[model samples]
Target: MRGITLALDAMGGDFGPDVIVPAALQALRYYPQLELLLVGKPAAITNYLVKYNSISNDRISIVPTKYIINSEAKPSQAILSSQGTSMRVALELIKVGRAHACVSAGNTGALMGLAKLVLTPIAGIHRPALMVILPHQNNGKTVVLDIGANIKCNAMMLVQFAIIGEVIAKQIIGVVNVPRVALLNIGAENTKGFGNIHQAAKILSNISSINYIGYLEANELLTGKTDIIVCEGFVGNVTLKTMEGVIRFFLSLIKSSDDSVQHNFSMNTNIVCNFSYMNPDKYNGAYLVGLCGTVIKSHGAANQQAFTTAITQAVKAVERQISKKIASRLAECWITTE
Candidate 1:
């Protein structure tokens, strides 16, 4: 297999270079064919590389930048002032074909805005969706999309999300059979959601190519009944955060339990191991799909391991030629968001 290069926004996350440098080093060790373009202040990146004794590594290179986007900057504001920032520079690397993919732990809105501007969307895609894979009850994985990309979506956009989700389930998640896709709704009944959602559902049901299951309520998200869940960004974002909060709460309860109870919990290796699956770190990378190139959004507060996971996710997407696969799948559909 030919080696691939990834552009890293080393100054974008909460801990910036302090966290990113180590993650880059770790990923290099894990993948012998991997190369990194660390985009940030040279001094800052060098300090950490020296600390890790990887400053002189042949595979690592630093691309210096003069500015960093503010974590709280709005998308519009960030776009206007984006030049010279590490995040924008890293993305530009992909635009110029210097890197195969880009990964950043930065302000979500800015990253989304910069990426759309620099990398451009796929030919037929109106908007790119933020996608993540979540663990399901049956020990399988579920692909959820539009997590935080577009806060408001119309019937056509929701339908488009289903199409994108379906392709993702098959190509990325490796779903063998026809992937069952569903709309996230307030109720499982046909008439229980907003007009656009109902319209989207009706449209999905008519498509012969999609395995469109009717509706899925929020409570049944982990039931493993569906392969892909599609929703507007506002609802999907809230749902993801709520699930994360609940997982953290459940883990805390186990930690604060009585000694005997904790001892019993620990002894049940299966239960303990299952609970560990809920760790948010393992699911840190959110793929920004529907774009022409691969861009992964790492959690802003992610630790070293989580950031490394994000880098690996980018590698896999590039290796799989995910964007091309999505484009090919979309061409087969008759639906249009225009």
Candidate 2:
């Protein structure tokens, strides 16, 4: 297979070029065959590139852009204002086929909006969704989709997210034969939620794309039972933040409890106690799904490690052909057949 070229918007994250530069270098070390298109101020990148003592080589290229969409700016307004923002330029590279995939740590809404406007969703899909993989305590990971993209969704959309999520889980985590899925709800009962989730549960139960296991209580997520959690944007975002908060709390408690707790704790408790060992590939990153190219939204406060993992994830997305495979799988179900 030919090496994949990834276009990275290097200007927008909180840590800026300091994070993006090394992450790109680290990714290059891990995947020597990959080509990089770094979008940012040339002088800044050149200074860092030379500090690392590697001349601007053939494999590394810079596409300098003058404007950046700050994290404080409204996603819609920023998208409308600048055509040459680093993120937009990266998407253009993908549209014109200069790169196999695109990535940015900028405004999530604008990134998705611009991507949808430019790349276009797969033929049967109505709107693109945001999918994220969370490190689960079950010796594996769980895929959560529509985490703050398209707040209002129908039963059909959730079902489509399930199919898209399953394809991604298979590629990234190597799971096969359909991982178990659950609807995120206040409780496990079918009558426990409102119209969107309640109706979506019934459809999921009959759908064969995912091994639908009924509704999942927020408390039951890390039990190692469900592999995918399907829900609307607001609910998914809240659930994710709650999980992060709880984990951090417990992790602090464990560290403060005793000096020998490493040996005193059980497997499950130990997993929850260690934050350093379980640092998520990124602090907070979202991959824009259902588009022609792979793109990611990195947390504004992302550090060098987050950038490293984001780039690493993009490489996997490229190798796995996440966008193309998601579209093909959604077609098999005849989604959006009028």
Cα lDDT of model 2 by residue, 1-338, tens digit: 25989898988777778888887887788898988999988888888888787555778899999888887788789879859888889899999999988878887778888999888888888788888888776677788988888888998888889888888878987887678888888886667888978777777666555588888877777666778888898888787778766766766766666455556656546555455434544435677788878887777677777887778778888889888898887776565331
Best by lDDT: 1
lDDT of 1 at 270: 64
State the number of backbone clashes in model 2: 0
Error of 1 at 277 (Å): 1.5
Q: TM-scores across all candidates? A: 0.95, 0.90
Model 2, residue 24: distance off in Å is: 0.6
Error of 2 at 182 (Å): 1.2
Candidate 1 per-residue lDDT over residues 128-195, each given as its tens digit: 99989888888888999889999988888887788888877887778999999999998988779899
- At residue 167, what lDDT does model 2 achieve? 85
The 0-to-1 C-alpha lDDT of every candidate, in the order given, reads: 0.90, 0.79
At residue 94, give the lDDT of candidate 1: 93
